[model samples]
Target: MVTSIILMNVERSKINEVAQQLADTEGVSEVFSVSGTYDLVAICRVPTNDDLSELVTRGLLTIDAILKTETMLAFKAFSRHDLETMFTIGLDGI
Candidate 1:
């Protein structure tokens, strides 16, 4: 899976509507209304780079309320599960 962090600058009057639209879009897993340079942040998961492009360019940009967006591609994902698995490796002797 390919993960991306999309930061969106939405029209001030339509932040809620834009967020809802993004959340409803396929491949978008989560949407957050954040206080920062960007009005909203969307987490997306897709199968390929081409799908990511379609989602952000064709799908997300089509939202009339979204003024601009910045997409960040994730190179790797580190989670508690990964840490636990690492620490547990070869620990049976303990």
Candidate 2:
């Protein structure tokens, strides 16, 4: 999967609306309202680079409330949740 962390600058009045839209968008796994230089952050996981491109250019950027965006492509993922799942693969029956 191609994972993208998208930082978005949205119009102040539309932050909530835009976040909801992003969360509802296909390929977008999560949307967070954060405090910092950006108003919101969206985590997207998609099948291919082409899909990511389509999602950003056509899906995300098309939102009128989104003033700007910075997309970061993830090369690798390191998470404690993944480690825990790996170690517990078949322990559920116990």
Candidate 3:
């Protein structure tokens, strides 16, 4: 899986609506309404780079309220959930 994080700035009146829309969009795994230089952050996962392009350029950029975005492509991922799953293998019933 390819993972990308998009830091987004939406129109002040439309941040919530844009975040909700992005959360529902295919390939977008999560959307966070945040405080700082950006109004929202969207986490996307896709099978290939082409899909990632289509999602960011065609899907996300097309949203009317979205003003600008800075995207970061993740090269590696480390999460507590992955560690937990790894350690719990074969221990389902205990």
In terms of TM-score, the best-performing candidate is: 2
Regions of candidate 3 where Cα sits further than 4 Å from its true position = 82-94
lDDT (10s digit) by residue, model 1, range 19-84: 888889999988999997999999999999999999987997689888888999999977523444
Candidate 3: residue 73 Cα off by (Å): 0.1
Steric clash pairs (candidate 3): none
The lowest-lDDT stretch of 10 consecutive residues in candidate 3 is 78-87
lDDT of 2: 0.92
What clash count goes with each model?
0, 0, 0
Compute the lDDT of residue 57 as modeled in candidate 1: 78
Least accurate 10 contiguous residues by lDDT in model 2? 79-88
What does candidate 2 score on TM?
Answer: 0.84
Would you list the C-alpha lDDT of every candidate in the order shown?
A: 0.89, 0.92, 0.90
- Give the per-residue lDDT of model 3 (tens digit) for 1-94: 8999999989999988898899889999889998899999998999999999999889986799999999999998775344455568696634
Clashing pairs in 2: none
After superposition, candidate 2 runs with Cα above 4 Å error: 80-94
Residue-level lDDT for 29 in candidate 3: 88
